[model samples]
Target: MSDVDQSQLFEFLCRMGDNTLVLGHRVSEWCGHAPVLEEDIALANTALDLIGQTQMWLGLAGEVEDKSRSADDLAMLRDVWDFRNVLLVEQPNGDFGQTMMRQFLFDAWHLAMLKALTGSCDDRIAAIAAKSVKEVQYHVERSGDTVVGLGDGTSESHRRMQKALDLLWPYVGEMFVADAVDEAMAKAGVAPDPATLRDAFDARVEAVLTDATLTIPDGGFAHKGGKTGFQHSEHLGHLLTQMQWLQRAYPGATW
Candidate 1:
C-alpha cells in the first residue's frame, strides 16, 4: 500500500475507534444512575463491550500508523478537535429516552457498516468487523426494542421519545457523508462508502419507528466535521475534561 493509503487507513480506523470510545464513555456515565437496576447493569455491560472493541480498533490503528501510541493513549490523550467521533455519539445524554434514541440510531448505522466491513480487503479490518458485529447485533436489538417500548408506551413516554428523536435527528447526517477518507477506504475495499449504508439504515429505522408509532422529521440537514476531526460540538470538550482529567493530571501514572 502507498503512504497515502496507510494514512487514510489510519483515519478510517480512528473513525471507528473514536465512535466507540466516545459513545462508550457517554454510556458509562449512566452506571448506577439508570432508572432501574436492570437498566443500570445493561448500560454498563454495553459500555464495557464498546470499550473492549475500542482496544482492538485503536490498537490496529496504532499499528497501521506505526506509532508507539496504544489504544489508551488515543482514548485518553486526544483533544476535542483531534478526535474523530461522529457528532451523534458525543451529544449529551439528555434523558433515558434520548440516550436510547442515540443508541438506536447509531446502532442501526453501526451494524450495517460492520456487516459490510466483514468483507473488507484488509484482513485486519475484516476480523475486527466480524468480532464487533456480534456485539452490535445485540446492541441494535436491545436499543430498537427500547425505542419501540418507550415510543409506544404511555402518552408521556411517546412524547418524550419523539422529542428525543427530533433533537437528535440532525446529527445523524454526519454518519453518512462520505469524505475523501471514506472514498479511499471504499475504493480499497477496506470499508463501504458511507452513502452505500444509508438504504439499509433507513429501512431498519423506518421499520422500528413505524412499530413504535413515531414519525421521522421532514427535510434532511446533517451536521458534519466530527469524524474528520475538523470540529466537534461543545459537549465533547466537557466530556473529555471529565474523561481525560486523570490521565492529564497524573501523566503516565498507572495502576
Candidate 2:
C-alpha cells in the first residue's frame, strides 16, 4: 500500500475505535439509573465490552500511525469533528427503550461488520475483530431480546419502543456507505467492504424486529454524515467536552 493509503487506514481505525469508546462512555452513564437492576447490569457489562474493544482498536491504530499516544490519548483528546464513528452510536440514550433500540440497531450492524473484518488482510485488525466478535455477538443477542420484550410487551411499552426505533432509523444509512478510504483499504484486503455486510445486517435486524412485532419504518429521509468527513450531531460536541476535559486539563497526568 502507498503511504497515503496506510495513513488513511490508520485514521480510519482510530475513527472506529473512538466511536466505540465515546459510545461506551455514554452508555456507562446509565449504569445505576436503568429502569431495572438486571438491565443496569446488562448495559454496564456491554459498556465494558465496548470500551475493551475500543482499547484494542485504538492501540492498533496508534501503532499503525507510529504515534506514541496511548489509546486513552487517542480517545480523550480528539475533537468532535475528528471523530469517525457513525452517528447512530453517539445518539443520546433518551430512555431505556431508546437505549435498547439504539443498541439493537448498532450491534446488529457491528456484528456484521466485525464478522467480515475477521478475515481482513491487516492481521492486527483481523485479530482484534476475531477477539471482539465473541463479546459483540452476545451484546447483539441481549439487546435484540430486550427490544423484542419491550416492543411486544404492554401497549405503552410497544409504543415507546417503536418510537425509539423510528428515531434511530434515520441514522442507519451512514454505516454502510464505503468511501474512498474504505475502498482503498478494501482493495488491499486490509478492510472489509461494509456494503457487503448490509444484506446480512438487514436480515438480522429484520428478524429481531419481526419477532418484536415492530414495523420497520419506511422511506424516511435517512439522515447521513459523521463518517467520511462530515459534521456530527450536536450531542457529540457535549460528549467530547465532558470526555476530554480531564485529558486536556491534566495533559500527562495518570491516575
Best by TM-score: 1
The digit string of per-residue lDDT tens for model 2 on 101-141 reads 99989899889888888988777788999999999999999
Off by over 4 Å in 2: 1-4
lDDT of each: 0.94, 0.86
Q: Model 1, 1-255: lDDT tens per residue?
A: 343488889999999999999999999999989999999998999999999999999999999888798999888988887799999999999999999999999999999999999999888889999999999999999999999999999999999999999999999899999999999888877889999999999999999999999999997999888999888999999999999999989998789
TM-score (C-alpha) between model 1 and the true structure: 0.98
Candidate 1 C-alpha RMSD relative to the actual structure: 1.0
Give the lowest summed-lDDT range of ten residues in model 2. Answer: 1-10
Off by over 4 Å in 1: 1-4
What clash pairs does model 1 have?
A: none
